[model samples]
Target: MFDWLYVLMKKLVENVFGLSLDTGIGDSVHFFFYDSVKIIILLGFMIFTISYIRSYFSPEKTKEYISKFNGISKNVMASFLGIVTPFCSCSSVPLFIGFVEGGIPLGVTFSFLITSPIVNEAAFAILWASFGWKIAVLYVVMGVVLGVVGGIIIDKRKLEKYVEEYVYEMQMNRPDIEELTFKDRINFAKSNTLEIIGRVWKYVLVGIAIGAAIHGWAPEAALTKYAGPGNPLAVLAATIIAVPLYSNALGTIPIAEALLMKGVGLGTAMAFMMATTALSFPEMVLLRKVIKPKLIANFVAITAIGIVFIGYMFNGIAHLVI
Candidate 1:
């Protein structure tokens, strides 16, 4: 099983990036690499399905109104919306910016931001179709829980005060932040959807490469050695393992599959994948361009803790029930 996962991940990285590292199985890699390309093409079709649907199906006026909710209700609401709304990081920043500029609460915005990338339509569809409704439902609920709790934690830390001075000055409480007209709403959604997909395509490919490699070559022994049952430090270790790698939204699929195949605990693998990819180094760098370091630290700390909790929570539940 370990060898199978390793072969899957290694071939993925090679094909996506044109990288050529020996997985010590020269001839076999060629075959897996071919299949990996098919996987990439399939994922591309799926990612764009969500992206274009956001353009065709959603109205901008509604988003404009919802974006203004700016409170805890809005946070959960945004999380729920994030489950279906297709967005990548770059596209999301502008939506996030518009909300902030329009005076939405930071915590509510965070909820939307976190959940959108982690719980896209493709993710739900994949889990639902492949795993079953129970797991799919659990995935959505946990995603919302992560976003809502993480938002509140960030808010309570008074981290809003740490937004870059420019962003701070930009906050408003205008009564006029209402829904847009139908034409304007649809146009807005379409534009934002396209912009987000365009900006994130690169990140997705990069993510797929890393994920593919992990799938192709990660050692089962290492997974069990580091994250197996009875390991009390597993959660923290998982977080630490995930910090340097990065992916966003759709890119996590291959990596997660590979790790799971290797006997890594669901919670631990998820914690690492979520932290490294969803709230990534590049995203932090981009955010720091707009937010203060203190705010960044707080954001990182909150999400990291949230992911760790998720890691343990799912692990405990899985063991108890299964």
Candidate 2:
């Protein structure tokens, strides 16, 4: 479907600018244009479609629905719900608090928190576009599993004491939800599409620019030597390095693509992406407003371990999928 975009970029680089496709700079420029345009178009369309579908599931409605479920089923439902809601880590905090106030288990709330930023529609669309459906499906499945497992661990540990006392005492006032017509839903989707694209466009450009540079100039030998499948610690190093630096999955996907092209191990690149999106420092800071420090630490530690495990698993089976 996007072959024309690649051909057009090739012509623009080689014919219009007189740069040969054989040169590194020419290939880098083509990559930047092709990926940037392709991601933007895919992002816009997916965000609109998702926002439209999301219009039906308000936070109030979601809380009510999840409240009906119990045990592992609640965690599973919450994680699946997280996939449809396009909240980044920090943005997910407010809904996290709402879920807490609504009497949802801390573990189930954590499930939603973990999955929302890591595996939304935007990430799925970009992954499918860049790496084919097999990898995209794998990513989504892994993300959900991580969420569910993390939630179960937290629940099993009975870590509710780590949550702030005020959270339990505060009463939540349920506001009336306004009914929307078809046109209203369309407008909401349009506005949401524009809002999200406006927010993440710069990240997309910067990510693609970095990816382009790596695509054009980075040494394959160095990448393979350090972060390749042969390096047992590659996934661990990737995950550790990613925690302090934050970006949404959309931004990180391009870098992941670049790393893959440079022969970086599949597990290492994915671990980096997951840690960047899900274990960000700013997110921890925001989460601190509601939860105590120990719970925060537990959340980080559990989620990080799950991400690393998934990374290794992916690396082990990469050939079968790729």
Candidate 3:
């Protein structure tokens, strides 16, 4: 549906503007315009749909479900809930604090934290739009697996002792908000869709602009030489670089698409996306207020190892599936 729409839009733009969509600046323009429209349309629909689905459940319900699980199932439940919880990394600290104070295990909370930023629906939407369902499914599976494994490792180490003493002592008093009706949910979805698209469209444009420029002007030889699947260190390099950089997954998706178009390896692109979203210096710094440096270091190290493994694994198998 989107491909046909893109073709029609491209033709319309060409006819309306008296420009070609196949060559030089026109090619770049068409790529940017087509991708921008496609991504925004997908983003709105996906966000609204997910938000409407979310209306069926509440945060209290999610916590209840998370608290009920034990062992590996606990990690799984927490990680899955993290994807649907609708909180950004910065706001997650308060939830984490509340969970810990309410007697939820540290490992389970970590599971939630690990997956929340990494496997969001916005990222999923863009990945689906840019790379298709196979890769999108792969990304979600790997993200959840990373969360589960990281949580289990933290559980084994009995790292609850490493959490800051102050977190347990602090008391929170939150007022409950009323649940929304179906009509309210519809309104909420509309507002959320607009708000998200309004905030990120510039990033999308910038990313696509960079992508469009590279698509038309950059030399594929240089990109292929350095970040190609054949390069043994490309995945590692991408993962390492992404650790400190800070960008939302939505913003990074277009750039990753561009990199792939310019001949960067699939694994390398995946690793970069994982690193930027899953692990970041600011995230670590924020976490330090609640967790000791040693545990924080372990979290980073373990997550990085998993991300690198996924990068290499995907790079090796991407050609087979893609």
Candidate lDDT scores, in order, read: 0.63, 0.86, 0.83
Ranking by TM-score: 2, 3, 1
Per-residue alpha-carbon lDDT of candidate 2 for residues 145-244, written as tens digits (9 for 90 to 100): 9999999999999999988888788787777778999999999999998987898888878888999898999999999999988898999998998887
Please estimate how well model 2 matches the true structure, expressed as its whole-model Cα lDDT. 0.86
Q: Model 1, 1-322: lDDT tens per residue?
A: 1346456766565776555655434323543454345444434555555555565433234366566665578778867776656565666555666667766688877877787766765455444432345665677788888888887777677767777667656654434545456676556655654565565556555544565565556777888777765576887887876777554544554455455656667677556656665577777777776777887787778878888888888777755432
Segments in model 2 whose C-alpha atoms lie over 4 Å from true places: 86-94
What order do candidates take by lDDT, descending?
2, 3, 1
Q: Pick the candidate with the highest lDDT.
A: 2
Write candidate 3's Cα lDDT for 238-295 as tens digits: 8888877666456777878878988888998999988888987777888888889999
After TM-score superposition, what is the CA distance of residue 194 in candidate 2 from its true location, in Å? Answer: 1.3
Model 2 is weakest, by summed lDDT over 10 consecutive residues, at 84-93
How accurate locally is residue 138 in candidate 2, as Cα lDDT from 0 to 100? 94
Q: After superposition, how far is residue 76 of candidate 1 from its true place, in Å?
A: 0.8
Q: How accurate is candidate 3 locally (lDDT)?
A: 0.83
Better of 1 and 3 by TM-score: 3
